[model samples]
Target: MRTTLNIEDDVLAETKVWARRQGLSAVQVVFRLLRFVLSGGMEQAETGSAVVAGFRRFQETSPKLVTNEQIDQLRDQVGL
Candidate 1:
Protein backbone atom coordinates (compact mmCIF):
# COMPACT_ATOMS: atom_id res chain seq x y z
CA MET A 1 0.00 0.00 0.00
CA ARG A 2 2.65 2.44 -1.08
CA THR A 3 0.90 5.61 -2.19
CA THR A 4 1.51 9.36 -2.01
CA LEU A 5 -0.85 11.26 0.28
CA ASN A 6 -1.38 15.03 0.46
CA ILE A 7 -1.47 15.40 4.21
CA GLU A 8 -1.65 18.83 5.81
CA ASP A 9 1.56 20.17 7.44
CA ASP A 10 -0.06 20.48 10.87
CA VAL A 11 -1.47 16.95 10.72
CA LEU A 12 1.90 15.59 9.60
CA ALA A 13 3.61 17.28 12.54
CA GLU A 14 1.01 15.88 14.96
CA THR A 15 1.43 12.39 13.53
CA LYS A 16 5.16 12.64 13.91
CA VAL A 17 4.75 13.59 17.58
CA TRP A 18 2.30 10.75 18.12
CA ALA A 19 4.69 8.33 16.41
CA ARG A 20 7.54 9.35 18.69
CA ARG A 21 5.36 8.98 21.79
CA GLN A 22 4.26 5.52 20.72
CA GLY A 23 7.78 4.47 19.65
CA LEU A 24 6.42 3.72 16.14
CA SER A 25 7.18 5.02 12.67
CA ALA A 26 4.85 7.56 11.06
CA VAL A 27 3.59 4.87 8.65
CA GLN A 28 2.80 2.49 11.51
CA VAL A 29 0.96 5.17 13.43
CA VAL A 30 -1.10 6.16 10.42
CA PHE A 31 -2.04 2.57 9.54
CA ARG A 32 -2.93 1.72 13.15
CA LEU A 33 -5.05 4.85 13.52
CA LEU A 34 -6.76 4.25 10.19
CA ARG A 35 -7.55 0.67 11.15
CA PHE A 36 -9.03 1.75 14.48
CA VAL A 37 -11.30 4.35 12.77
CA LEU A 38 -12.35 2.20 9.82
CA SER A 39 -13.22 -0.72 12.10
CA GLY A 40 -15.61 1.47 14.26
CA GLY A 41 -13.24 1.24 17.26
CA MET A 42 -13.16 5.04 17.40
CA GLU A 43 -16.78 5.07 18.58
CA GLN A 44 -15.91 2.98 21.58
CA ALA A 45 -12.83 5.09 22.25
CA GLU A 46 -14.88 8.32 22.19
CA THR A 47 -17.63 6.91 24.41
CA GLY A 48 -15.13 5.44 26.89
CA SER A 49 -17.25 2.28 26.99
CA ALA A 50 -18.86 -0.37 24.83
CA VAL A 51 -22.23 0.24 23.15
CA VAL A 52 -25.19 -0.55 25.34
CA ALA A 53 -28.22 -2.61 24.44
CA GLY A 54 -31.31 -0.66 23.21
CA PHE A 55 -29.08 2.08 21.83
CA ARG A 56 -30.46 3.69 18.65
CA ARG A 57 -33.91 2.10 19.08
CA PHE A 58 -35.19 4.21 16.21
CA GLN A 59 -33.16 2.13 13.81
CA GLU A 60 -35.27 -0.92 14.73
CA THR A 61 -38.64 0.83 14.32
CA SER A 62 -40.54 1.00 11.04
CA PRO A 63 -40.83 4.35 9.27
CA LYS A 64 -44.16 6.20 9.09
CA LEU A 65 -45.99 6.16 5.76
CA VAL A 66 -46.87 9.54 4.25
CA THR A 67 -50.12 9.25 2.31
CA ASN A 68 -50.69 11.15 -0.93
CA GLU A 69 -53.83 12.67 0.62
CA GLN A 70 -51.76 14.06 3.50
CA ILE A 71 -49.22 15.47 1.01
CA ASP A 72 -52.01 17.16 -0.97
CA GLN A 73 -53.50 18.61 2.21
CA LEU A 74 -50.13 19.98 3.28
CA ARG A 75 -49.56 21.47 -0.19
CA ASP A 76 -52.95 23.20 -0.07
CA GLN A 77 -52.38 24.48 3.50
CA VAL A 78 -49.05 26.00 2.52
CA GLY A 79 -50.40 27.59 -0.70
CA LEU A 80 -48.09 25.38 -2.72
Candidate 2:
Protein backbone atom coordinates (compact mmCIF):
# COMPACT_ATOMS: atom_id res chain seq x y z
CA MET A 1 0.00 0.00 0.00
CA ARG A 2 2.34 2.62 -1.24
CA THR A 3 1.02 5.98 -2.36
CA THR A 4 1.94 9.62 -2.53
CA LEU A 5 0.18 12.64 -1.04
CA ASN A 6 0.62 16.38 -1.43
CA ILE A 7 0.45 17.59 2.16
CA GLU A 8 0.92 21.22 3.06
CA ASP A 9 4.33 22.10 4.48
CA ASP A 10 2.94 23.43 7.79
CA VAL A 11 0.64 20.45 8.20
CA LEU A 12 3.49 18.01 7.56
CA ALA A 13 5.77 19.79 9.99
CA GLU A 14 3.14 19.77 12.73
CA THR A 15 2.36 16.12 12.09
CA LYS A 16 6.05 15.26 12.35
CA VAL A 17 6.30 17.03 15.68
CA TRP A 18 3.20 15.32 16.98
CA ALA A 19 4.41 11.95 15.76
CA ARG A 20 7.75 12.42 17.49
CA ARG A 21 6.07 13.40 20.75
CA GLN A 22 3.80 10.35 20.58
CA GLY A 23 6.74 7.99 19.88
CA LEU A 24 5.31 7.06 16.49
CA SER A 25 6.80 7.30 13.01
CA ALA A 26 5.34 9.81 10.54
CA VAL A 27 3.75 7.05 8.46
CA GLN A 28 2.16 5.43 11.51
CA VAL A 29 0.77 8.74 12.63
CA VAL A 30 -0.65 9.52 9.19
CA PHE A 31 -2.13 6.04 8.89
CA ARG A 32 -3.81 6.22 12.27
CA LEU A 33 -5.15 9.71 11.55
CA LEU A 34 -6.57 8.61 8.23
CA ARG A 35 -8.14 5.55 9.80
CA PHE A 36 -9.66 7.59 12.57
CA VAL A 37 -11.13 10.13 10.18
CA LEU A 38 -12.53 7.45 7.91
CA SER A 39 -14.02 5.70 10.96
CA GLY A 40 -16.04 8.75 12.12
CA GLY A 41 -13.57 10.07 14.70
CA MET A 42 -14.05 13.58 13.33
CA GLU A 43 -17.74 13.46 14.24
CA GLN A 44 -16.91 12.73 17.85
CA ALA A 45 -14.45 15.62 17.98
CA GLU A 46 -17.06 17.94 16.48
CA THR A 47 -19.58 16.86 19.11
CA GLY A 48 -17.39 17.93 22.03
CA SER A 49 -15.70 14.60 22.71
CA ALA A 50 -12.09 13.71 22.10
CA VAL A 51 -10.06 10.54 21.80
CA VAL A 52 -7.16 10.39 24.23
CA ALA A 53 -4.35 7.94 24.75
CA GLY A 54 -5.39 4.36 25.57
CA PHE A 55 -8.39 4.80 23.22
CA ARG A 56 -10.58 6.61 25.73
CA ARG A 57 -13.15 9.19 24.64
CA PHE A 58 -14.54 11.69 27.15
CA GLN A 59 -17.58 13.91 26.71
CA GLU A 60 -17.50 17.52 27.75
CA THR A 61 -20.42 18.78 29.82
CA SER A 62 -21.31 22.24 30.96
CA PRO A 63 -23.97 22.41 33.69
CA LYS A 64 -25.48 25.83 34.29
CA LEU A 65 -25.25 25.92 38.04
CA VAL A 66 -24.67 29.64 38.47
CA THR A 67 -25.32 32.84 36.51
CA ASN A 68 -22.84 35.56 35.67
CA GLU A 69 -24.33 37.82 38.39
CA GLN A 70 -23.80 35.14 41.00
CA ILE A 71 -20.20 34.74 39.90
CA ASP A 72 -19.68 38.51 39.96
CA GLN A 73 -21.16 38.77 43.43
CA LEU A 74 -18.95 35.99 44.67
CA ARG A 75 -15.92 37.63 43.11
CA ASP A 76 -16.74 40.98 44.78
CA GLN A 77 -17.28 39.31 48.16
CA VAL A 78 -13.88 37.68 47.85
CA GLY A 79 -12.35 41.25 47.85
CA LEU A 80 -10.93 41.10 44.36
Candidate 3:
Protein backbone atom coordinates (compact mmCIF):
# COMPACT_ATOMS: atom_id res chain seq x y z
CA MET A 1 0.00 0.00 0.00
CA ARG A 2 2.02 2.91 -1.29
CA THR A 3 -0.29 5.63 -0.08
CA THR A 4 0.24 8.88 1.76
CA LEU A 5 -1.23 9.44 5.21
CA ASN A 6 -1.45 12.95 6.63
CA ILE A 7 -0.77 12.27 10.28
CA GLU A 8 0.30 14.60 13.06
CA ASP A 9 4.07 14.69 13.31
CA ASP A 10 4.30 14.12 17.06
CA VAL A 11 1.81 11.23 17.02
CA LEU A 12 3.56 9.62 14.08
CA ALA A 13 6.89 9.90 15.88
CA GLU A 14 5.41 8.39 19.02
CA THR A 15 3.87 5.56 16.97
CA LYS A 16 7.27 4.91 15.36
CA VAL A 17 8.87 4.74 18.78
CA TRP A 18 6.23 2.32 20.05
CA ALA A 19 6.57 0.21 16.92
CA ARG A 20 10.30 0.00 17.43
CA ARG A 21 9.79 -0.95 21.07
CA GLN A 22 7.44 -3.76 20.02
CA GLY A 23 9.82 -4.88 17.23
CA LEU A 24 6.97 -4.50 14.77
CA SER A 25 6.94 -2.47 11.58
CA ALA A 26 4.92 0.74 11.87
CA VAL A 27 2.41 -0.63 9.36
CA GLN A 28 2.08 -3.87 11.27
CA VAL A 29 1.47 -2.03 14.55
CA VAL A 30 -1.19 0.18 12.96
CA PHE A 31 -2.95 -2.74 11.30
CA ARG A 32 -2.96 -4.89 14.42
CA LEU A 33 -4.29 -2.08 16.59
CA LEU A 34 -6.94 -1.21 14.04
CA ARG A 35 -8.06 -4.84 13.82
CA PHE A 36 -8.28 -5.14 17.59
CA VAL A 37 -10.57 -2.09 17.66
CA LEU A 38 -12.60 -2.23 14.45
CA SER A 39 -13.24 -5.98 14.68
CA GLY A 40 -15.69 -5.20 17.58
CA GLY A 41 -13.79 -7.69 19.80
CA MET A 42 -12.59 -4.95 22.14
CA GLU A 43 -16.01 -3.31 22.58
CA GLN A 44 -17.81 -6.65 22.88
CA ALA A 45 -15.47 -7.79 25.66
CA GLU A 46 -15.76 -4.45 27.44
CA THR A 47 -19.55 -4.39 27.11
CA GLY A 48 -19.88 -7.96 28.40
CA SER A 49 -17.70 -7.18 31.38
CA ALA A 50 -19.55 -3.94 32.13
CA VAL A 51 -22.93 -5.61 31.81
CA VAL A 52 -21.97 -8.25 34.35
CA ALA A 53 -20.41 -5.70 36.70
CA GLY A 54 -23.28 -3.16 36.58
CA PHE A 55 -26.35 -5.36 36.26
CA ARG A 56 -26.83 -5.21 40.03
CA ARG A 57 -27.13 -1.40 39.85
CA PHE A 58 -30.51 -1.79 38.09
CA GLN A 59 -31.91 -4.31 40.59
CA GLU A 60 -33.79 -1.60 42.49
CA THR A 61 -35.29 0.12 39.48
CA SER A 62 -38.87 -0.76 38.55
CA PRO A 63 -40.69 -0.53 35.25
CA LYS A 64 -43.04 2.43 34.93
CA LEU A 65 -45.56 0.44 32.95
CA VAL A 66 -46.33 -3.11 31.93
CA THR A 67 -47.81 -4.76 28.84
CA ASN A 68 -49.18 -8.11 27.84
CA GLU A 69 -46.92 -11.14 27.40
CA GLN A 70 -44.61 -10.43 24.48
CA ILE A 71 -44.85 -13.85 22.82
CA ASP A 72 -48.64 -13.87 22.88
CA GLN A 73 -49.10 -10.25 21.76
CA LEU A 74 -51.63 -9.37 19.05
CA ARG A 75 -49.27 -8.31 16.26
CA ASP A 76 -52.07 -6.87 14.12
CA GLN A 77 -52.76 -4.06 16.62
CA VAL A 78 -49.46 -2.36 15.72
CA GLY A 79 -49.51 -3.70 12.15
CA LEU A 80 -46.48 -5.77 12.94
Candidate 4:
Protein backbone atom coordinates (compact mmCIF):
# COMPACT_ATOMS: atom_id res chain seq x y z
CA MET A 1 0.00 0.00 0.00
CA ARG A 2 1.19 3.53 -0.75
CA THR A 3 -0.14 6.94 0.12
CA THR A 4 1.03 10.52 0.39
CA LEU A 5 1.08 12.41 3.69
CA ASN A 6 2.57 15.73 4.65
CA ILE A 7 4.86 15.42 7.65
CA GLU A 8 5.96 18.47 9.60
CA ASP A 9 9.50 19.73 8.95
CA ASP A 10 10.67 19.13 12.53
CA VAL A 11 9.08 15.67 12.59
CA LEU A 12 10.77 14.72 9.29
CA ALA A 13 14.13 15.95 10.58
CA GLU A 14 13.76 14.05 13.85
CA THR A 15 12.62 10.92 12.01
CA LYS A 16 15.75 11.10 9.82
CA VAL A 17 17.94 11.45 12.89
CA TRP A 18 16.15 8.54 14.58
CA ALA A 19 16.52 6.43 11.42
CA ARG A 20 20.28 7.10 11.31
CA ARG A 21 20.64 6.27 15.01
CA GLN A 22 18.66 3.05 14.68
CA GLY A 23 20.36 2.00 11.39
CA LEU A 24 16.97 2.10 9.61
CA SER A 25 15.72 4.07 6.66
CA ALA A 26 13.25 6.97 7.14
CA VAL A 27 10.55 4.79 5.55
CA GLN A 28 11.19 1.97 8.01
CA VAL A 29 11.06 4.31 10.96
CA VAL A 30 7.80 5.83 9.74
CA PHE A 31 6.32 2.41 9.13
CA ARG A 32 7.26 1.22 12.59
CA LEU A 33 5.90 4.39 14.21
CA LEU A 34 2.70 4.21 12.22
CA ARG A 35 2.22 0.57 13.11
CA PHE A 36 2.81 1.25 16.77
CA VAL A 37 0.35 4.15 16.75
CA LEU A 38 -2.28 2.35 14.69
CA SER A 39 -2.10 -0.60 17.07
CA GLY A 40 -2.86 1.69 20.00
CA GLY A 41 0.53 0.93 21.55
CA MET A 42 1.00 4.63 22.13
CA GLU A 43 -2.29 5.20 23.94
CA GLN A 44 -1.49 7.44 26.87
CA ALA A 45 -4.24 6.30 29.23
CA GLU A 46 -3.40 2.64 28.80
CA THR A 47 0.38 3.09 29.00
CA GLY A 48 0.51 5.74 31.69
CA SER A 49 -0.57 3.38 34.46
CA ALA A 50 2.11 0.83 33.57
CA VAL A 51 4.77 3.51 33.37
CA VAL A 52 3.70 5.00 36.69
CA ALA A 53 3.69 1.60 38.36
CA GLY A 54 7.15 0.82 36.99
CA PHE A 55 8.45 4.15 38.27
CA ARG A 56 6.91 3.44 41.67
CA ARG A 57 8.62 0.08 41.82
CA PHE A 58 11.93 1.62 40.83
CA GLN A 59 11.52 4.34 43.44
CA GLU A 60 10.81 1.73 46.10
CA THR A 61 13.93 -0.28 45.18
CA SER A 62 16.26 2.66 44.49
CA PRO A 63 18.23 4.59 47.08
CA LYS A 64 17.25 8.21 47.45
CA LEU A 65 19.99 10.66 46.48
CA VAL A 66 18.39 13.64 48.23
CA THR A 67 15.66 14.29 50.77
CA ASN A 68 12.72 16.71 50.51
CA GLU A 69 14.27 18.83 53.27
CA GLN A 70 17.55 18.99 51.37
CA ILE A 71 15.69 20.03 48.22
CA ASP A 72 13.84 22.73 50.18
CA GLN A 73 17.12 24.02 51.62
CA LEU A 74 18.69 24.15 48.17
CA ARG A 75 15.65 25.95 46.78
CA ASP A 76 15.76 28.49 49.62
CA GLN A 77 19.48 29.05 49.06
CA VAL A 78 18.78 29.74 45.40
CA GLY A 79 15.92 32.16 46.35
CA LEU A 80 13.51 29.98 44.41
Candidate 5:
Protein backbone atom coordinates (compact mmCIF):
# COMPACT_ATOMS: atom_id res chain seq x y z
CA MET A 1 0.00 0.00 0.00
CA ARG A 2 2.97 2.29 -0.28
CA THR A 3 2.70 5.14 -2.77
CA THR A 4 4.05 8.60 -3.39
CA LEU A 5 1.85 11.65 -2.76
CA ASN A 6 2.30 15.29 -3.73
CA ILE A 7 1.24 16.88 -0.46
CA GLU A 8 1.99 20.53 0.10
CA ASP A 9 4.90 21.32 2.41
CA ASP A 10 2.80 23.40 4.81
CA VAL A 11 0.06 20.76 5.03
CA LEU A 12 2.58 18.01 5.67
CA ALA A 13 4.24 20.08 8.39
CA GLU A 14 0.93 20.71 10.08
CA THR A 15 0.00 17.04 9.87
CA LYS A 16 3.32 16.07 11.46
CA VAL A 17 2.76 18.51 14.32
CA TRP A 18 -0.74 17.18 14.94
CA ALA A 19 0.46 13.58 14.76
CA ARG A 20 3.13 14.27 17.37
CA ARG A 21 0.55 15.80 19.68
CA GLN A 22 -1.60 12.68 19.35
CA GLY A 23 1.34 10.25 19.80
CA LEU A 24 0.85 8.79 16.31
CA SER A 25 2.89 8.69 13.13
CA ALA A 26 2.05 11.06 10.26
CA VAL A 27 0.85 8.12 8.15
CA GLN A 28 -1.49 6.98 10.91
CA VAL A 29 -2.99 10.47 11.13
CA VAL A 30 -3.51 10.57 7.37
CA PHE A 31 -5.28 7.21 7.31
CA ARG A 32 -7.52 8.28 10.21
CA LEU A 33 -8.47 11.43 8.32
CA LEU A 34 -9.26 9.43 5.19
CA ARG A 35 -11.44 6.97 7.11
CA PHE A 36 -13.27 9.79 8.86
CA VAL A 37 -14.12 11.51 5.58
CA LEU A 38 -15.15 8.32 3.78
CA SER A 39 -17.44 7.25 6.64
CA GLY A 40 -19.82 10.24 6.39
CA GLY A 41 -17.63 12.90 7.94
CA MET A 42 -19.44 14.29 11.10
CA GLU A 43 -22.61 12.21 10.85
CA GLN A 44 -21.69 9.63 13.39
CA ALA A 45 -23.66 6.78 14.90
CA GLU A 46 -25.47 6.82 18.27
CA THR A 47 -23.45 8.18 21.17
CA GLY A 48 -23.18 6.41 24.51
CA SER A 49 -20.69 5.05 26.96
CA ALA A 50 -19.18 1.88 25.56
CA VAL A 51 -18.12 -1.16 27.55
CA VAL A 52 -15.20 -3.33 26.57
CA ALA A 53 -14.20 -6.58 28.22
CA GLY A 54 -16.84 -6.08 30.91
CA PHE A 55 -15.54 -2.65 31.89
CA ARG A 56 -17.61 0.47 31.23
CA ARG A 57 -15.67 3.37 29.77
CA PHE A 58 -16.02 6.93 31.04
CA GLN A 59 -14.41 10.29 30.50
CA GLU A 60 -11.60 11.39 32.78
CA THR A 61 -12.61 13.71 35.60
CA SER A 62 -9.16 14.71 36.77
CA PRO A 63 -7.98 18.21 35.96
CA LYS A 64 -4.32 17.27 36.21
CA LEU A 65 -2.05 17.37 33.20
CA VAL A 66 -1.46 13.87 31.86
CA THR A 67 1.61 13.62 29.70
CA ASN A 68 2.59 10.92 27.22
CA GLU A 69 5.35 9.87 29.59
CA GLN A 70 2.79 9.13 32.29
CA ILE A 71 0.67 7.11 29.88
CA ASP A 72 3.67 5.09 28.72
CA GLN A 73 4.72 4.42 32.30
CA LEU A 74 1.26 3.11 33.17
CA ARG A 75 1.14 0.99 30.06
CA ASP A 76 4.48 -0.55 30.92
CA GLN A 77 3.37 -1.27 34.50
CA VAL A 78 0.35 -3.13 33.15
CA GLY A 79 2.43 -5.01 30.58
CA LEU A 80 0.35 -3.60 27.74
Candidate 6:
Protein backbone atom coordinates (compact mmCIF):
# COMPACT_ATOMS: atom_id res chain seq x y z
CA MET A 1 0.00 0.00 0.00
CA ARG A 2 1.26 3.45 -0.90
CA THR A 3 0.48 6.32 1.39
CA THR A 4 1.97 9.61 2.58
CA LEU A 5 2.71 10.38 6.21
CA ASN A 6 4.76 12.96 8.05
CA ILE A 7 7.61 11.66 10.18
CA GLU A 8 10.24 13.40 12.26
CA ASP A 9 13.64 13.79 10.61
CA ASP A 10 15.56 12.52 13.64
CA VAL A 11 13.38 9.45 13.80
CA LEU A 12 14.11 8.60 10.19
CA ALA A 13 17.79 9.12 10.76
CA GLU A 14 17.85 6.91 13.83
CA THR A 15 15.83 4.26 12.02
CA LYS A 16 18.26 4.29 9.14
CA VAL A 17 21.17 4.00 11.50
CA TRP A 18 19.54 1.14 13.39
CA ALA A 19 18.63 -0.60 10.16
CA ARG A 20 22.19 -0.42 8.95
CA ARG A 21 23.49 -1.82 12.21
CA GLN A 22 20.87 -4.55 12.43
CA GLY A 23 21.19 -5.43 8.73
CA LEU A 24 17.50 -4.76 8.28
CA SER A 25 16.02 -2.50 5.61
CA ALA A 26 14.35 0.81 6.48
CA VAL A 27 10.95 -0.57 5.47
CA GLN A 28 11.30 -3.49 7.85
CA VAL A 29 12.35 -1.19 10.67
CA VAL A 30 9.40 1.10 10.04
CA PHE A 31 6.98 -1.81 10.02
CA ARG A 32 8.38 -3.15 13.29
CA LEU A 33 8.27 0.29 14.91
CA LEU A 34 4.71 0.87 13.71
CA ARG A 35 3.59 -2.42 15.18
CA PHE A 36 5.21 -1.55 18.49
CA VAL A 37 3.47 1.83 18.51
CA LEU A 38 0.06 0.43 17.61
CA SER A 39 0.42 -2.27 20.24
CA GLY A 40 1.16 0.32 22.93
CA GLY A 41 4.40 -1.40 23.80
CA MET A 42 5.91 1.88 24.91
CA GLU A 43 4.83 2.83 28.43
CA GLN A 44 5.63 6.54 28.45
CA ALA A 45 2.17 8.06 28.05
CA GLU A 46 3.50 11.61 27.83
CA THR A 47 5.94 10.87 25.02
CA GLY A 48 4.66 9.17 21.93
CA SER A 49 7.16 7.02 19.97
CA ALA A 50 8.90 6.17 23.24
CA VAL A 51 7.22 2.77 23.20
CA VAL A 52 9.58 1.58 20.51
CA ALA A 53 12.41 1.89 23.03
CA GLY A 54 10.48 1.42 26.24
CA PHE A 55 10.38 3.89 29.13
CA ARG A 56 13.60 4.60 31.04
CA ARG A 57 13.62 6.92 34.01
CA PHE A 58 16.85 8.85 34.53
CA GLN A 59 16.02 9.36 38.18
CA GLU A 60 17.52 6.10 39.34
CA THR A 61 20.74 7.82 40.42
CA SER A 62 19.10 11.01 41.66
CA PRO A 63 16.11 9.84 43.65
CA LYS A 64 16.97 12.07 46.61
CA LEU A 65 17.86 15.20 44.66
CA VAL A 66 14.69 17.08 45.66
CA THR A 67 15.01 19.27 48.72
CA ASN A 68 12.60 18.80 51.66
CA GLU A 69 11.64 22.50 51.48
CA GLN A 70 10.41 22.10 47.90
CA ILE A 71 8.55 18.95 48.79
CA ASP A 72 6.87 20.58 51.77
CA GLN A 73 5.94 23.64 49.72
CA LEU A 74 4.35 21.52 47.00
CA ARG A 75 2.65 19.34 49.58
CA ASP A 76 1.10 22.34 51.32
CA GLN A 77 -0.04 23.86 48.03
CA VAL A 78 -1.70 20.59 47.05
CA GLY A 79 -3.13 20.11 50.56
CA LEU A 80 -1.26 16.85 50.81
Candidate 2 per-residue lDDT, tens place, 1-80, comes to 77899999998999999999999998889999999888878867776565555254445476457889998999999987
5 against 6, candidate with superior TM-score: 5
What's every prediction's RMSD, in angstroms? 8.9, 10.1, 9.1, 9.1, 17.3, 7.0
Of candidate 3, the 10-residue stretch with the lowest lDDT total is 51-60
Per-residue CA lDDT of model 3 for 1-80, tens digit only, reads: 58877879897798899999999988888788789877665655655533443342243255565466653476766777
lDDT of 1 by residue, 1-80 (tens): 57899999999999999999999999899999999987768766766665567242233256799999999999999999
lDDT of 4 by residue, 1-80 (tens): 88998999999999999999999999999999989877556654343543443342232455668989999999999999
Per-residue error (Å), model 4, residue 15: 0.2
Model 1 C-alpha lDDT versus the unseen true structure:
0.82
lDDT winner between candidates 4 and 6: 4
- Alpha-carbon runs more than 4 Å astray in model 1: 49-80
Q: TM-score: which is higher, 4 or 6?
A: 4
Taken over the whole model, the C-alpha lDDT of each candidate is 0.82, 0.82, 0.70, 0.79, 0.77, 0.77
Query: In candidate 5, residue 80 scores what lDDT?
Result: 100
Per-model TM values vs. the true structure? 0.57, 0.57, 0.48, 0.54, 0.50, 0.48
> Which residue pairs in candidate 4 have backbone atoms (N, alpha carbon, C) closer than 3 angstroms, thus clashing?
none
What TM-score quantifies how close candidate 6 is to the native fold? 0.48
Candidate 6 has an lDDT of 0.77
Residue-pair clashes per prediction, in order, are 0, 0, 0, 0, 0, 1
Q: How many Å off is the CA of 6 in candidate 4?
A: 1.2
| Model 5: per-residue Cα lDDT over 1-80, one tens digit each | 78998999999999999999999999999999889756645233222443445454444567589899999999999999
Model 3's TM-score against the true structure:
0.48
In model 5, which runs have C-alpha deviations exceeding 4 angstroms?
42-80
